[model samples]
Target: MVNRVEITEAAAAVVARLEAQHGPLMFHQSGGCCDGSAPMCYPAGDFRVGPQDVPLGEIAGCRFYIGAAQFDYWRHTQLIIDVVPGRGSGFSLEAPEGVRFLTRSRVFTDDEVTELAARGEPERAG
Candidate 1:
C-alpha cells in the first residue's frame, strides 16, 4: 500500500517561493552514509522517482517524493523536514542531525510509512 506524505509550514513556504520564481517544487532522496539517505530539492522535471517513493503530500502545488531506502531508515526516526532558502529561489530541506540525505529519490511504499509510523515518530503536517 502507499500513503500520502505531509509537509510543514517552512517547507510549504519554500515550495511557494520556488513555484513563484521557478515553476514547481521537487524533492528527492538517495543513498548516503550515516542514515543512508539524504533530501534534495530540484527544478521541475529534474528528478525521477525510484522504488522507494513516498508521497510526502504537497508543498505549494507540487508533490514531494522521498526514496524507499531513505524512508526505511527514517521510518521510526523523529525526522523533521524544514525548507531553508538559499540565494535567489534556491531552497533545501533541514533534516535533524544524524540524518543523511540521499540527494535523489526512490519513493516510499505504504508498508514503509506504516512501519515507520509504528516506530513512534509523529509525522508533522504543518
Candidate 2:
C-alpha cells in the first residue's frame, strides 16, 4: 500500500531525539495560515485528535494527521515530513530544538491513486 505520509532520514533522527525526551509523539497538520500550515508535533495525546482529522499513517513511530479540510486538498499527494534548521512554531514541541518540522509533498501517480482508492478511505480520528 502507498503511504499517505513518510519522513526523511533527518526528520526521523529528529523524531528519535524528541521521542527520547517526550516519550511518544504525534503530528497534526491544520489548514490555517502560516505556522498553522506547518505540521505541529506534540507529545502524544497532548494534542487531541478530533473526529474530523484524517490519519495519514505513521512516520518515525508517530501518527500523522491532517484536518479534514486539509485532507480534501491534499488527498492526491503524498506528504513528506522533513526537518530544517530554524525555529518552528512555538506551539510545536520541536521549536525548542531550533529545528522545525516541514511538510513537502508530491502528487501521486495514477496507479498509486487507484491503489489508494481501492484500499478505501483512511480511518478518521475519533
Q: Largest lDDT belongs to which candidate?
A: 2
Off by over 4 Å in 1: 1-4, 34-37, 77-79, 84-126
Write the residue-wise lDDT of candidate 1 on 54-82 in tens digits: 65555456666666655566554333445
Question: Which RMSD values do the candidates have, in order?
Answer: 9.4, 0.8
Question: Could you tell me every candidate's TM-score relative to the true structure?
Answer: 0.51, 0.97
TM-score of candidate 1 versus the correct structure, residues matched by position: 0.51
Global lDDT of each candidate: 0.51, 0.93
Tell me how many residue pairs clash in candidate 1. 27
- CA displacement after TM-score superposition, residue 107 of candidate 2 (Å): 0.4
Clashes by residue pair, model 2: none
